[model samples]
Target: MFGESSGRWLDSELWHACAGSMVQMPPLNSKVLYFPQGHAEHAHGGKVDFTTRIPSFIPCWLSGLKYMADSDTDEVFVKLSLTPLTQENTNALLMDLEDGGDDCGNNNGGVVEGGNQEKPASFAKTLTQSDANNGGGFSVPRYCAETIFPRLDYSADPPVQNIVAKDVHGNCWKFRHIYRGTPRRHLLTTGWSNFVSQKKLVAGDSIVFLRAKDGDLCVGIRRAKKVAVGGGEVSVSSVVEAVSCGVNGRPFEVVYYPRGSSPEFCVKASVVRDAMKVRWCSGMRFKMPFETEDSSRISWFMGTISSVQLLDPIHWPNSPWRLLQVVWDEPELLQHVKCKT
Candidate 1:
């Protein structure tokens, strides 16, 4: 006997159970990379310097929280502290330029603005022994060789091109680029050794190159962090202190500065999905990480999200990643804005 009342009650009960189990998950705070396309490595063997293996235009994305566990009644989260990797944040982490403090041995011209104009156009490379030695040549990444450097005449036996670049000090140097090797790698020859000698650069230092709005190439340097001191073993505390410090209720330091600037700093797709689960709204209080120039330490900047704006509709329409306009309590730092998950 088919009972209409029983069937109706059973269907209703099943619908309610399904609805209860569909409770939305909270947004996850995870790290991600924004890797651009077409920047793949060709050579692989020996001790590969992963730093050099990074693609051009890379920037690190550091979040202030990490996921722990979830419970039915309450969810658990862990606070994560990270340092800024971009040059502007690195300058803030290493020096105290804000209050007319001393410049912390930065050879690169005063910190340049890192807005949209600079982030996409700039690239960095860590110097290698071969780059600083009397070998008279330096290896150039494939992406830089193809997109950033001048065009090469492949018809020639070796396919060569000459590039004139200006350092932060406004000094110009000419470098010759040649495509050679079994897989045809790009190398900077001729004047590379001269530039290295003039700059007094050594292995472990980094060279940053930026294409100015005027179409001229500009270069800068970032010295590597010193590990050993006075024949004494490097302590973990000293290493942590070298990168960040707390002062006036703020923490500043460099967390992860990659050897190259690549588009890979964008958050991963899975991380984005987790982040989207959270219902974010304006006026939310958050602690953003930044580096202080005086100590090169990582610090936190407390601010409230003022508004959310979509990416340029011309290029990205209805994009899930939105720009966040953050207004810090300090008026001087009011202009800082970041991308939201």
Candidate 2:
């Protein structure tokens, strides 16, 4: 009688085990595409119409993951995804989408060859004493100045320009940029102190700047990582790293992935708080993108929360970054595994 059995139950068990294995596998650092409005066919079509398009998908790097506690269960049920590139940094990206056009006017009143485009530069620099003190200037690296800033008019004295910088909140800050001193360097004077004060930036935090396609400057902040000394609980800090200018020039925090092998993505404090406010329960369906071997491709997986794990006594009881075990469907993966979402 055992031999005559169809063995359907055994097959089901094996299938679930395989799905669980896939979910338990650690994710790697790779590029993935994010479609804000689910998936659309026109996204893959050539000559995408930006006008009628609600919002196009963006490609970004996946940095890491952090677990958060479920408010209902008071256990970790959600994982916070992290990435360095956020929508705030999309100005440069959007410009690239515009067929290599340089709207930033040059001295010749003409677009420079290759659209005067330079690869976006990113680096970490500690705030100096002058930057931390009341001094109204922030020193910029010479390489950053030359690459990220508009081409300077050396003929003009001081080589100064009034720049309108957009913050993570899409707030426009008018600042003065001048190339001055004996050897000649780049500095953000006048409004520098105000920005520092408003953002509560200190001597240790790092600043990130990017030049958009329209020659407008954008800025982001990166706080130094904190150690959990003797604690295993994962805590989400309210740190703002990068800012992206959304539709109608609304500035919002750009998710920042720090420079390291971490799986944590730096998101706005408000985002974390908002997510935690939602009640997540076991058996609830969860969907998120997963990277394929190509890195350029992205696939979505749907899973149900199997169990919520509470933090150890040594861990922070209130921390949101906790652990959740999930079980995914198999046949769905076979059908949609290669499709972009």
Candidate 3:
């Protein structure tokens, strides 16, 4: 069923390369493709592997290619071309897409990359209304920033920072920051980290932490919007649904499986929040016991946070990331959604 699955499995690595940049010239004309995973039962032979599952090769003419991190392989590749536009314009295009949930070829309310020559005020108005009714807005309570960023080494490794803010309608909006630095892994401050544990974050889930109108930290989990497994087109409505339908309460995991290179070894994971130490800042450390399958049974691994990078807001300025903790879970599932046992 893996090969015949309708969606594409975007290389997480491509997400890293494309991170913080805006107005990407994708290798393909902003279209999705379908590729097969070597596992599941439909490979050319009964056996398959990551190298065997790399998506069809598409090269970018304008954008340079980069990977998410060292361990990433070609299977994580995403089609993106480098653009010659300013970081601001590039960011604008990206922010526009993420905000409006529209894709490159969207013409109904057609917004062009490197276009928008109209008055700045008009453009600003259009941009602000993009997600107005959707409860998207950006404003960080000074307490939230002081409480989170500094702890994440924002003072030292500052990359772009972003926060989720809300409007009178109880709608949450994301605010992103643009900063200078080589990208680093972002950490959730003590409060938000606890919040994640409270929410049981999975791979595709997006968590938004905001200062509630009542002046408290609140979190929202937006699942990673899925496209076709290997590659296929996704609709804007689907993206909006991903954001709008985000779970707004604490979550618990039913099973836990660490990330792996093989398929047979994979298992699902479920996490329920446990109150640990409170009031820790970003980058603060905590210990958790994780169980993984070595061969047949499970083994325990002591986990520590290696690093944390605040998602660049300029790119996704109005999206949320307050309690966004990107910690390493060995039994990490390849995708965020839980698979059936």
Candidate 4:
């Protein structure tokens, strides 16, 4: 039966050429042959099964020729074929339409390394405001809270394990545990489980921990289901915030980077040259081989600013992006949790 009850003939070339392969144009340079014989007895729904294959393609080709072709074929196969009359003619007419619409965006639709159009801006702004409005009040730097609680080593630790945490929006983040070797740092890392519980992370979520220059720890989330790179699983190698054991207990800071934020702010070469002198809580920052890709917009805490601000509109100004401040209780208590020297 090949998983189709409508009696509509399956088109393997139409689906494989468009949905199965990541290459958009299907490498027209090489010949492609799709045979109906492949699905004649496919009991598990075959290559032509609409249910399984359609959803898989949706995430892969979010916006490309494959996406376009799928949409067109779906319309004809699912709708026009049921028409009162001239169904064949209508289907033929639609197939004649050539593909277009690649000019308006990038390979991943609207994503371009450092580009933040609207979502990240809104998330950042919302977080900042909520944190400010909390009952215990927003989180301040460790230096500012010293009077309320005693300070710990706040040094960097080699990542013990890699974990993934995701937010409600379905974003994926790869996190590395840098608080290894001692019970104190373990407690601190364990405390992060609260975020996981509150956010309801399943087995596939991503959670990242970052240490900044002043010993402040930042938390980020990415849903597990959305992560597809490197076997679609979490690993310690993806950690960008690696620190030396000798640097442990010396103070560090945490910076939160949202998705789609922009490259101009993230990859400022001049700033990396003078990183030691910078002092800020969370804002535009860099990670990794800073010069490799020009499109990564970085977010972290640095400089003298107390809050994250919209770094002016470049790619999408009208729907401008901003940072979100998180509201948390007992910032002083969390700061008191000491780490071994």
lDDT per residue (tens digit) for residues 1-341 in model 3: 11112223333222322221121222322221111121222222223333221322111112222221111111222222222233454355444434543343322233323244321110000112212223333223333345432233346445445554332223344445333324433322323333334333344333233333234333332223322332212233322222222121111111001121222111100000011113435565645332221111223333444444434443323222222453545535523212211
Report the C-alpha lDDT of model 4 over 241-293, residue by residue, as the tens digit: 11111012121111111121111111111122233234435543323221101
Q: Scored by Cα lDDT, where does model 1 land?
A: 0.42
Against the hidden reference, what TM-scores do the models get? Answer: 0.36, 0.37, 0.19, 0.19
Between candidates 2 and 4, which one is better according to TM-score? 2
Model-by-model lDDT, in order?
0.42, 0.43, 0.27, 0.24
lDDT for residue 312 in candidate 1, whole number 0-100: 44
What is the Cα-based TM-score of model 3?
0.19
Best by TM-score: 2
Models sorted by lDDT, best on top: 2, 1, 3, 4
Could you tell me the lDDT of residue 265 within candidate 3? Answer: 11
Model 1 lDDT tens row, 59-91: 233334222211211111122243234567434
Q: Give model 2's TM-score versus the native structure.
A: 0.37
Please provide, for model 2 over 177-261, each residue's C-alpha lDDT reduced to its tens digit, 9 standing for 90 to 100. Answer: 8999978889989898888887667776556566654555666544433212201122122111111222233322222112212
